[model samples]
Target: MGTSWSLQAVAPPAGTGGGVQAALDRVVAQMSQWQAVSDLSRFNRAPPGEWHGIPAEFAEVVAAGIDIGTASGGAFSLAMGELSEAWGFGAAGPVDTLPDFMVPSDGGIDLDRDARRIRRSKGALLDLSGIAKGYGVDLAADWLLANGVRHFLIEVGGELRGEGIRPDGHPWWVDVEVPPSWAGAGWRIALHDLSIATSGDYRRGLAVDGQHYSHSFDPRTGRPIANGVRSVTVVHRRCMMADGWATALTVLGADAAIALADEKELAACVLANGREYVSRAWREMLG
Candidate 1:
């Protein structure tokens, strides 16, 4: 939510930037962990055993997160805000060690789709950093399209979506982010009605006593990832899915993630231990 965005639309309407900002403001108002008054923050601060009402958009994101978490075998979780906070990766500021006064870990979460509400069984903190930005990107793109701005590329906080070709008839071409350890030319691909999201350890991390830890936490263990995974990149029609998959695949590491990608027929690439693992679908996409 604390990032920059840009849009390149073919003959975009006037005040396109204003429309994009308004759309993103909706996402922030609903999901920003940094904003204590946000729906997500209020849900986090809520006591156990009470249903909290939220907007349809929040419900949608949560539903998708649950689906991805279940499919990833718990590699991705939405109720990990507390863990992130304990590890100094949250809005509550940094802490070197886990607090002793921690509340009972929740039994995960419950959602009432028809009611547009969610509940915490015990005490769970919900965080949507992994996927909310991509969802924001989607919302902005939808706004552009609704305003008759077709053939546009929208990027918000690194998550990206592109549709149609540029005015010059060139597709929206993007280079996959290369990890620091990678050698040789970076991979380039065209985003034609597709979105790309990347999750990585090298970009931002935590340092403790001279040992480094990835900002990405494995919710299963409530700890930062130590797996030799460097990064994961996923391309999908929905940036939300791509973002969530990138996080889940990063947690799953290269081998297992690749297997899952192939099984799910997902386009993804995992860079780990100085080696690259590309899914069969990714190879096909690149080709």
Candidate 2:
């Protein structure tokens, strides 16, 4: 997680701010791909076909990643670590040529929940950059609540989760930013015990040979998605789900993304081809 994070909670007993910062730091240390000694990095470097034990938090995130990937039909995959690095999005920076690697099948990586162990069958690279920040937000929220702060809002990067009302007795409000490429009044939503995450091409991308490559990659093509969809936002009770869904929908583009959002009954907004599409569930939430 190479992004800024903020936590706003009902004033906790004095001197508790350090505890929140420590908890967030732990999440970064455990999951950041940029950190050489992170749990995820060690797991990625581990020899294939060998069962490696991981921390409970790492296991939980990986489990959630696999579940979301399956549900999104591979639109969201943790196995794109190599692809990300090849495209210069990872710590390795950009390479002159894309790495030669076979895309991992859905079941290429196996996780044993009971044993907290994982093994990869085909040397698949694991990258959790897309969802790790959201998980961090959730972890921070839980820390605040457990430490006697019930009203709080947690945001890492652009992913956010909020619950309860502020000390002023108002629900947490967030303004969804409009993509720079689009023209419109920004949308605002009152978040109460719900989380929202947004994905956009304008945020992080690489330009090569006079063409732009987004960080969001389509697993099917093993390349950056060039879909006309510029952004996707999803709201869910859990920030992690919203984060993953936003990225998945962005890769799926507008039509398919909206269709899947409806199929899953998710509250989502997709900005594509100079148009905005809101899922039925999102409209219901707005109302």
Where is model 1 poorest over a 10-residue stretch in terms of lDDT? Answer: 97-106
RMSD of each: 1.9, 2.0
* lDDT per residue (tens digit) for residues 1-287 in model 1: 88999988888878999999999999999999999889888888879789988898899899999999999999999888777777777897777755454332456878888898998766587889988999999989988889898899999978899999988889999988877757745678799999999998988776767888788878777767888898899999999999999999999988999999999999999888878899999999855
State the displacement of the C-alpha of residue 53, model 2, in Å, after optimal TM-score superposition.
1.1
Per-residue C-alpha lDDT of model 2 across residues 19-87, encoded as one tens digit per residue? 777777888788888999988788789887889988888888889988888988989888878778877
In model 2, the runs with Cα more than 4 Å from the true position are 94-107
What is the alpha-carbon lDDT for the whole of candidate 2?
Answer: 0.84
Q: List the candidates' TM-scores in order.
A: 0.95, 0.94
